[model samples]
Target chain A: MASKRSNFNRRKSFDAVRAVVNDVRVLVARGLTKSYGDVQALRGADLDVAPGQITALLGRNGAGKTTMISIIAGLLQPDSGSVELGGIDVFSNLDAAAKLTGIAPQETGVYGVLTVRENLEFFANLAGVGRTERASAAAEVADQLGLTELLDRRAGKLSGGEQRRLHTGCALVHRPQLLMLDEPTVGADVATRAQLIESVRSMANEGAAVIYTTHYLNEVEALDADNVIIDAGQVLARGTREELVEEHRLSGLEFTLDAPLDAAEVERLGATNTEGNTYRTTDDRPIGALIADLGSQSEGLLGIESLRPDLETVFLAVTGDRLDEGAS
Target chain B: MDAIRAIVGVQLRIIRRDPWFLVIMFGMPLVIMPLFVDTIGLSLQAEGYGDASGAEQVVPGQVVMFGFMLAGSVGFSVYREHGWNTWDRLRASAAPAPSLLAGFAIPWILIHLLYQVTLLVTGALLVGLRLKGSIIAEFLVLLSYSCCLIAFVLLLTAVFRTINQVNAIVNLGAMVFGGLGGAFVPVDGLPKIAQYLSPFTPSFWAMEGHRAVFLEDGGIADVLPSVGVLLGATVVLAGLAVTRFRVDETKEFFG
Candidate 1:
């Protein structure tokens, strides 16, 4: 845990320095620390997303992703940090930064009393979109999110997925330079998720720096985004899917027993307890070898599975915990 | 200015879409005015005015009383954004706190003025509430009271973190201020202590202004003190609300 944090600190420090030296990144957030009473939401986190790049903030719930995004979006103030969007300091000149940034929070927020078109136009107007252009902007965003048909429907009356689309649509209506979406697909259906992912990609291609936060590894993979692994309010790793997997590959058998094995038996199998009664072999080991080693205790075996090297494995290797378990 | 305008525009639209709350509240005061207008008229007659009809006391009293109750809706609108989960979205716009509050205050103040006017006209028709004073003076009093009450409720909204807290205070304030400020009866009929305490409530000043026009046949110059007091209170309350309000503050609505 200490080494992972140390490595992240080193890399983040370098990234922060690079961000200062060059203006290549559209959004740069450095050393953000925020605490809510006793709970620290963020701790010296650093992130930089350049134009036309989608960086996925991959973390479980309560992993500071929302807090970081909120700070970047200027919806929050950090204890100590600086956020610059399009060469303007976010906290210093919030209005200017706001004009260049668009954020969709983790929760779906739409003006339910208003029609979808009204919701979109209101947000656009609030974001400084011109009177003459707001209608076209709303219509364009609606088309992109497949919300055109439901534009006149009250947001409260729309289906959950439709409302979700409108919620995301309101963020992009003004065509901000940097877009931050915090778990936009959390409660969305498969079709909605696909549509959102496609829209995110399209936004990036249109030169909007995008920060996408989600717990779903599959979504990250589908976007093929540069992944930033965050846990316990710190950034542990930042790389692409293949890069992360190759850097921290794992191949082992994970076996769960009805009852936990004693330390002696655990040592005999050369396994480490992950959680509960589950034990995993640290080295690449076949199920047959583990079965042979379990011997008499094999009767107590409840489940066994092989671990493949993937983003999930990478997350486990870096954070020493399962993202899927934390997510659920 | 543009941000404030945008906020006002959307808020007015939202209110227009769902105006049942205001409609229901408008009916409440009109119903209560006639119930005790006659008894209050006799109380006024005994107190002196031989030609007094109860409409003078009952109409403005109901307006002031229910207007206090209705002012809470502005506070509710602020907390309702949290319930709708759009508070953060508004914050993301980076609109200054004053702009945001004004955005809300502007539409509700106009609506509140409309509410008072409609009730006054309707009550006058129902119970024959003759406007003896200048119409412009009556309008000024209505506008001042509207601004004053809206500012006070917004101050309460800024101070409280939950709609429940604001709701409790607003409900208690309506009854206490109304009962003390002679909303149910003429101030002369109330106990001396109640009358003394009446001046502290916004309802007291508003009722005083209404009576000036409704009973005394006062013109703009006659009601200037009441209007001045209400507008001054508006400034203080609005200043406090702006100081206390934190756009980033988390306000709970449902829970």
Candidate 2:
């Protein structure tokens, strides 16, 4: 416990120094740790997002993404941490930070009984937009999200995708300086996803710092966002996709056999059995050399494939787990 | 202030869209009030209300009884926000707890008063119910009762984890408080035990103030004590509600 306490103090000091150095960042969240009873949700997690940049926060279930977002949005108080939005401490001055920050939580939360326009304007109004500007703000958000035609209709009557769009639209209607969308495309349709991505890109282009959490790595690539991979409540790695891919790239040969190889044969090939009947080796040897080394065991070979280095491969390398396997 | 105003507007709009519950609440008592009039009139006469027509007892009785049930709607609106998954969005707006509670309290108080007034006016038209006292005094009674009941239910909203618990309590409260506090029968007619327990309920003070207007020809000055009890209770209940309310706590709306 003493060692753990020392490490926590070290992280806090490091975050304080980093906060001072990164003056241009729109959001600086540091040393964020939260726990629910005996279960620790976050442990000294630190993140920074600059203006006009999109940070795709990738994490599996129980990875503390929602908790972190909720803390930043001022919904849940963190056990220990500080979030600064546009240089203002979020929890200390939540009302002022609320005007500068907007968040779309993981759930679809649009008011079903209200018209789309009403839902949008209500959120805008709640965020402190002037009465005269709320109407125009709602219209602007609806037009951006392609909900102009359905503005007058009740939110419940719209399609699932439309409701999803409206949910996101409400968050951005206030034009917050820092926008956090927690899995915005979970149940969205193909078109809805595309539209949301486009809108998010535009928002970033207009100089809002965005933290988007998702299990879909392709969305990260599509948004061309900087990647932050969190697991077990810690941000393990964060960088551009290309940067992460290059830094953590894994190259290997994987082959499946009709039957499991004996321990002797596995050692001979210097390969590890990744799963049933599938063996992998991260050696730089050519496939020809590995196949020749297989010798008589080659007769049992079913297939051979080369692993390509990409975000998925990098994610697997960093977290030792598949992204799709953890996604709901 | 803006957050509170927006929440009030949204809450009122939501109610306007789904108004059948309030309509039924209004209609049910109107039906029951006439049924109990003749029976309760005899009791009021025996109690020495010289010109009592029973409308004097039954009309405000129904209002106070059903008014307890109607006040529960404020708590329901709060839980409904959870059902719709919009509670977090509202919390994320950074509105203080007092602002959120006030937003809900304001509209329900207005609706509660309107509901009671409409019933009293209908009684005046249907059963020749006349106010022997100042109309303004009666309005104060209605206003104080509305404030007190809404505050009480909001405290329940803060303390309860599910809408079902609140519903059960509110339903039981309407009946128990109404029976004990002379909403269904005059305090003089209730058994000795209930009459002793009657003053503990907000309905008792409300009924006391209403009896001053409808039965005793009393002025605002005469009903101030009853109003004081309700307004004082409102302050205590509302303060408790604010303290107990937790924006981060998840409340279940539907079973």
Candidate 3:
């Protein structure tokens, strides 16, 4: 037990050092602008993704996340600016960049008529995996994504969650240096969502640069990574989780009442009214006093909900818009 | 080479998965050619055309008819690729443009070969007709002719947005040439102006080249002008296809 504990500590330390050592940018886009006639999809958007880390692209719908991923994947070209993968221009040198990048698009790009294994094999070959290595690579990806049993099933016949898993597996089969996944865990159950997040974390641990875009604040919370929040085709802010919430000047805390508290009670606690039976108190000093007073008023509080500063509050504070709005 | 193989493998899988494409590729020649050939035979019989072998003309006529069907079917396949958004995916892959073009061309060439062989067998079984030229020489002529037609289809796919427009355009061109270029009736009986215009049609050279081997007393050397025209057409159309091909997902053409 002691040896195992030491091993775990060693592994954790290695991950910490490796994370910082691999912080060099793997993909960089500057002033990227794309227009479809009059509607500008990207308005000088810029992003830098580092190696061996997950960067969550938090945005509302039509915020140009898909457009950014397309340009980085070499599927679309920007009218101005440039995207580079590992110091190579993606659009100008597609073949070279293709070796490093794999994209799991939002629309599920798998061929429905093919089996799950076949889809993985085909995409692996397209990504330059040799024939001899395809089967073993596919098996490894399937196992990592918990899709080993569904390998022979046709992709079209799978459930939405299963299809999403297969799509991620297909992208991972080549073990690409950069993986761009747009809404990777949308419509997934809790178990499947955990599996997807774990798979992504493992990939990052293997030294891949992963860019994940999702509207689900829970997904962003579940992931341990840097954050880039986009709004109106531009970067609103970017940093670590704590840094972003702090920079945005947003605070989060929760209180449980001995009984259903009235608006007067909530005001006495120095918390602002948010909704029915809910109040938000951002002042640290007032929260401490309220907690002390609550203990004195009642020793039998039925429940206490802990709230931590998270991406959702940071998003609302910075963009001045609700996170759920404009999510398609 | 890997890129080429991957593109071709994906395209072949898509083609095989669609039953309608298989029917058009293999069934159209078997079912449609005989109707046109019978109509030609009825016209010849009414005119007291030839000896006991007056039906022999129907055999060569069916071969040329097969050419027209092959051209239209292959051309429409290219248009369908555009409509289905498969072309956009192919372009985004690591596959080179040359490999993609070769992938599309190779399958159509195979379909053309299958149609030619089926036509020959069906003609012999139904009408007691046999090809007059060397089999190897005729195969070369047919392969060359199909390559030229595939190039034309590639050009149409590059320029046209709607499958309906491409179908209408290819069918209209096919009918004009099939009528005037001697696929149905002899061009000799048409007006002098029509006969003069026939040389410009791709089917005109294709039919003349096939007839030179299967109908007239002509060697491989004798069909040089027709071969030259087909090769020239292939080069120009391929050049246009390469120059005009653009894969942009944001274009209005997607709608």
TM-score, every prediction: 0.94, 0.93, 0.81
For lDDT, the strongest prediction is: 2
Q: Which stretches of candidate 1 lie over 4 Å from their true place?
A: A1-23, A325-328
Candidate 2 lDDT over B73-109, as tens digits, reads 9999999989988999999999999999998999999
| DockQ of all models, two decimals each | 0.81, 0.74, 0.30
Residues B1-255 of candidate 3: C-alpha lDDT, one tens digit per residue: 776777668666766776575565455545655555566656656655432243345555555655655665655555555554345445556566566677777787777666766776776776655566666656666777777877887777667766666667777766787777776676776799999998888777877776666655467886777788888989999899877766552222234
lDDT of 2 at B51: 86
Q: Which residue pairs collide in model 1, if any?
A: none
lDDT of 2 by residue, A264-312 (tens): 9899899998889998888898889988999888888899988778888
Clash statistics: count for each candidate = 0, 0, 0
Candidate 2, residue A43: the lDDT equals 95
What shift in Å separates residue A321 of candidate 3 from its native position after superposition? 1.2
lDDT tens digits, residues A78-110, model 3?
Answer: 989899889899877899898898887775556
lDDT of residue A169 for candidate 1: 92
Q: Candidate 3's error at B255, in angstroms?
A: 9.4
Question: Between candidates 1 and 3, which one is better according to DockQ?
Answer: 1
